[model samples]
Target chain A: MFDYLQYVRQENFPHIWCAGCGDGIVLKALIRTMDKLGLSQDETVMVSGIGCSSRTPGYVDINTLHTTHGRAIAFATGVKIANPDLNVIVVTGDGDATAIGGNHFIHAARRNIDLTVLLYNNYIYGMTGGQCSPTTPRGANASTAQHGNLEPAFNISGLAIAAGASFVARGDAYHVKKLETLIGKALQKKGFSLVEVVSPCPTAFGRRNKMASPVKMMEQLRDTVVSVEKWEKMTGEERKGRFRTGILRDIEKPEFTAEYAKLIEKMRPEE
Target chain B: MSNDRPGKVRMMQGNQACAEGAIAAGCRFFAGYPITPSSEIAENLSVMLPRLGGKFIQMEDEMAAMGAIIGAALTGQKSLTATSGPGFSLKQETKGYASMAEVPCVIVNVMRGGPSTGMPTLPAQMDVQQARWGAHGDRGVIALTAKSAQETYEQTIRAFNLAERYMTPVILLIDEITGHTTEKVIIPDASDIEIVHRKKPDKDPENYLPYRFTDDCIPTLAPFGTGYRYNVTGLCHNETGFPTNDSNEIQCLIERLTRKIEIYEDDIIRNNELMLEDAEIGVFAYGSVARTAQAAVRICREEGIKAGLLEPTVLWPFPTKAVLAMAQKVRAIVVPELNLGQMAREVSLASQCSVPVHKLGRVDGSPIPPQQLVEKIREVV
Candidate 1:
């Protein structure tokens, strides 16, 4: 059995996440994955941007960097490139990943750097009250958009794949086992990997969207998301408002830091 | 090509010398984006870093570039980034983050005309004030200005040393004239240069606090992966490096951040005084304009007038002591800059209006001629 408590900073508890919040579940999944891989705490680094999900790094017993809003990926990229031997992970929220940090997000993927990014998507900005985010659904109601958001939500997994990430997957908080496995696989990959977990924010997002309870929100995710195999069998009509989960793209490609190292060797003068 | 040769002289551009200086200072990681008058620094580093076994990344934007260098710095590597006016504006948020978090990094802002990309190819000292106050919140700043390739090289090495000693961001404010102008620079041997590294924590990892204040007001840094799993944040935090809402904790943190440089102002300030022994008129200048001021001072001496030059090598923490001393000795002061009266306002304030200060400025993408400065000095006298 993996002792998850060993990887947690008990002194830093209790965390600031609200009761019935899915961030705790996502946090547990990440800890379990790290435990399964036997990654030493000294060799791992957790980087986060500003959000409720970004607070996940503080509770973990690793070298954590709590950075400014929406720049976690950029910072993580630097950490990994500077020291390629260390295992680097970025914990970010939908607002932090897709809004102000969107440029860094796409570029990190495009470079295919060896960083494992876990994007906690709750469809609304939970930190700043409840504002409409780049990942907010087209018709969802938020504090900033009382009459329903007019912007279409971005498919985070799809964006990562399109941006040239070598490994991309999607998971939800309701399916803890599957999410843990997906995160483990992402860590095992040698290039840019992203696992977007559809989490729930009962305090900010759930109340405004009529899913006021955690059970109701999890049930909605369980019902609306289909497996990749099942998604292929579904017709266009059946997939209208639904999304797919599981590994969407996994392919081998030259990683950024590895390529840079090779370049350094080639450029070195003969001694 | 042989940097190992002691005192080897070669023709190099100011921007190239700045890049060479960074390598000489042991900067192992560079993250930057291309912008005019500053692009050569990035280009030179892109080739130089890899050959030196350092990492160089062309980031997506200025914000990412700044963020990347800070990340690398946390891992115990000397890191830097270069940019121009527009990019400098884009980098302010990260600059403030580095200041608050006390990350040691260097930012080279090759100034050009701007409020928003005013003139890309032209030179301007418009960013002197912005370099000091560009980042939000109350924080002390260290900025250096260079007038020639040799100074850019030496000042860049000093900038890195100061950044490491203070554990803060140091800005190298270079103008288009020096950044693009070519001159013969003597590259010194690596053994001859003095390099300063950040203080590392001597305590065990279990008892280490990343932001614990010591006698120097700077916390010892433990590089990531050294088994010290401490937290670094932009928030106001305690010695434990964790965010706290206690009023006293916030006050302690902010006070130390500002006081670390303020108390050490004597060691941080550097200025060059030229022929002030019997000068009745003083000319205050920096960056490329200082060259023009020096020439004007020479002309004034030859014409039987007593004029002198005071060029500030370090712009922020503003060299107030030297300016005040000059004010006491001279009847009047003249400040000529590429921007309209930016440093003039600083000189006037530093002098406390005890002496008459004259402002001469030009912003049409041209260097202030020596003749114009001589006339300004004459009028001030």
Candidate 2:
């Protein structure tokens, strides 16, 4: 087994995420990816917003900033631009990245700043006790949407691709190995990279929607999502309730920090 | 990059002077969104910051701008952001966070008329109260008001110094009149100015507590990515920088944050009293309105009304002692502001309504002329 314990705060063990929650699985994958990359804990900074998934930074043994609701990417942008040498990662949730923080999300991607964003999409506001999020599916039950959700869910990966993310990928907690690979690729990308994880939240989202057990929720994710290549071959009827998971978009562009550096050099006063 | 080689005089707008002052104060990061009366600061910084090897970013919104500066400040950089009334309101959310997290940064709010975008191109001092209480919480704010382009330059430097010294967000309140007006500013030699940097922890990384209170009630900060590996959160946290539900611990944290400024009240509070020794009537004012009051006081003194001016450069930590003393000595207090009796109420409360308090206000987005203040002084006298 990998020594993931070396990368986590031992005192912060027994995290606050509820039993059967997939946040731990995704967090472990992140740690393992960092471990594989041999990134020093001192040189890495994890920024998070206010949410259940945002709590991952507290357990990580790295320089962390637990910021306000929905502003992690904005804060991470500053950290990256201020000191581009540090590897900055932003951990946020569905509501944190798509609802209140949606503007920052798209703008950060538009700037193409070098940041690795891992958005844990549990489809409900778990921290606030099952409120309907921007990613909450249609006809889904939530505390705020007791009569069932009336709005269409946001395609997080699609949004990232449209917003000009240099590398956009999707993964699920059930496929831990694949999720680790996706995160590893994102960390290696230079510009804005987004990895949307379809993590399970048995306590808040699963229980309310009748998928009360972790196995049932993982089964739902496993049965519904197909690979991008497989998804392309599916007919409209077959793709009705299904989603696609894999690297959806990958392209190259001038990163914001490097462009800013060139601008500084060009504008600097001659000695 | 323009000319920092000592004793250089240049004609610059108030906003340009503010940007120059920030550069002189060693501000390395600036993130702001454009708003009228304050956009010049952003434009000047965009050109100036890169030239000086500093970072400048025009964030998507005021909230993001405020958040970015806080993030930059955490990395041990002197950061700043400028906006007008509406944008300032958006920034209050993260401004409160900066206060709670003990992040040192500067915020410049150039005054404009508004409950919400009331007058974008006009001047108003309505944000006087907002500067002190805009953000939700029991937190201390250091605010300075500048009356002229020259004063704006000097006060911007002082704002950064105070922010670093106290580890809090300092507000520089400028108005449309002063922010846009151009005047000659003497760029002082860099050696003549005093720059204060935040204290760094001397302890090893394993033993460092980001919020451990020292003798002065101020905690040393360790920059992110420096092997400190600590957390920074806006929650009511313990000395270790982790959230705590213990009421006593919360009380200690809040008290230390507030008392750090309260105990240093004398050093933090700054005011100027002109001809106050023999005056029977005192006019209290700040920002652009203070200029008119100074002129009005001159006219009143020539007309033998014994009127003087009390202008506070530092607005928060409120200058209570001076206001009370001025009320006792003067027969009446006249407060001339661009808003309808905002700081006037503060003067009245501070004086306990002992003296006849007259509030001369204008909300038409125009500055109160010196003659109008003189007329108000005559009516009070």
Candidate 3:
């Protein structure tokens, strides 16, 4: 078993998450992955916007910044550009990343800046007590959407891929083992890499959808997720309640900081 | 005093001077969006920052630009961003974060006419109040204004200096006219300029407190990626840099944030008083309006009217001491602004109604002409 205690701020324990929240599982997977990758705590920065997942930065013993709602990527962009040697990771959630922060989300991907974005898609705004989010499934019940959510869910990984992110993948809270593997790959990727984890919100999302039990939510995830390769073989009708997981898109490109370093060298005046 | 120092002299626009000034202040990171009257600062830095081994990034928007600079500042880089009215409004939330987090950065607002995109190409001092109270919280704000390209160059450096010294966001407010106007600026020699960097923590990493209080109230900030691993948040945090709900701790955090700047108010305020030695009437103005007010004061002196000018380069922390002293001597004060009586209200409060404070304002997207100020000064005298 990985000793996650080494990475966590022990004094901040009795953590803020409600009982059986998938965000904690995701957090465990992240630390385990970080440990496996041998990332230096002094050289790594974790930035987050406001949300339940944003609390992750406060718990981690690292150079962390808890920024305003939806501006974590923008802040992370500066950290990476200011010193490309530092490993910068952004921890954000569905509403924080896609609603108020959608512009920054797309632009950071477009810049292809060196940032690892761990987007926890809990399908609802859990911190604000289950408000309808950009990724809230259509017809799902939420505090704001008492009757049902009117908007279609966003394809988060597809959005990253379309916005020119060099690496994009999907993982789930139920699939914790594979999630670590996916995160490890993302941490090693050269450009803007995104791992959109379909983490479930048991209290806010599950209670309204009649899956109030955290076990039921995990079971639902287990039944629905297919590997990316297997997903391609399924017909459109067969993908009704299911989603794909694994490295959905990966490519090579000129990363923003590296290109900037080259520009600095080329523009330097002769001594 | 070092204006006559042997160095490069060039005629440049106020916005260009600001970019060069930022470089002189050891600003190695610039994150900005293209906003009217302020875009030239970004354009010039785009070419200059790279050559000088600095970093320049044209962010997605004004809010991101503000956020990026704050992030760069945390990583031990002197960072800056420039914007106008609407963009400044967008940046308020992030600017407030910079305030609460105690990040040292500079924001340059080249003022343009607005309540919202009112006029992009013209100059106005409408953001005077916004720069101080634009963010939601109660914070000690440092905002500086300039009258010409030469002053803009000098004040830009001072803006960075104050930011580092106090570990707070400093606003450099120049009107569109000042930003667009071209003038000769003498770039002081490298050895002639004094630069200030944020104090780095020398304490043991095992007991590092990012927001520890001191007698001076200013806290040393360790840059990220240097052995010190700490958390920074917009939420009210304890000395340990972690959020705390304890009321006493919250009270201390808020008070310290304000006190750090207030205790040093005398050192932060900068104003120029001209020919006020034996004058009975005073003209109070800033930015481009002050340039015209100086001319109007000269006109008043020539016409046998005892008139003087009080030009405050630092707008916030209000310059109350100087205004109070001037109020005691002058019979009446005339405040001519590009906006409708923003600073005039401050002048009234600062003067404590000892004498009547008169306002001469124009929001027609143009500067207050010297003749208008002359007429106003004549009426007041």
TM-score of chain B of each: 0.98, 0.98, 0.98
**What is the DockQ for all candidates, taken in turn?**
0.85, 0.85, 0.93
Question: What order do you get sorting by DockQ, best first?
Answer: 3, 2, 1
Ranking by lDDT: 3, 2, 1
Flag clash pairs in model 3. Answer: none
Q: Can you give the TM-score per candidate against the true fold?
A: 0.98, 0.98, 0.99
Q: State residue B107's C-alpha deviation in candidate 3, in Å.
A: 0.4
For candidate 2, what is the lDDT? 0.92
Give the lowest summed-lDDT range of ten residues in model 2 chain B.
Answer: B1-10
TM-score of 2: 0.98
Question: Which segments of candidate 3 are over 4 A away from where they belong?
Answer: B1-6
TM-score (0 to 1) for chain A, all models?
A: 0.98, 0.98, 0.98
Screening candidate 1 with a backbone cut-off below 3 angstroms (N, C-alpha, C), the clashing residue pairs are: none
Provide the lowest-lDDT 10-residue window in model 1 chain A.
A1-10
Candidate 1 stretches greater than 4 Å from native: B1-6
- At residue A155, what lDDT does model 3 achieve? 92
Report the number of the highest-lDDT candidate. 3
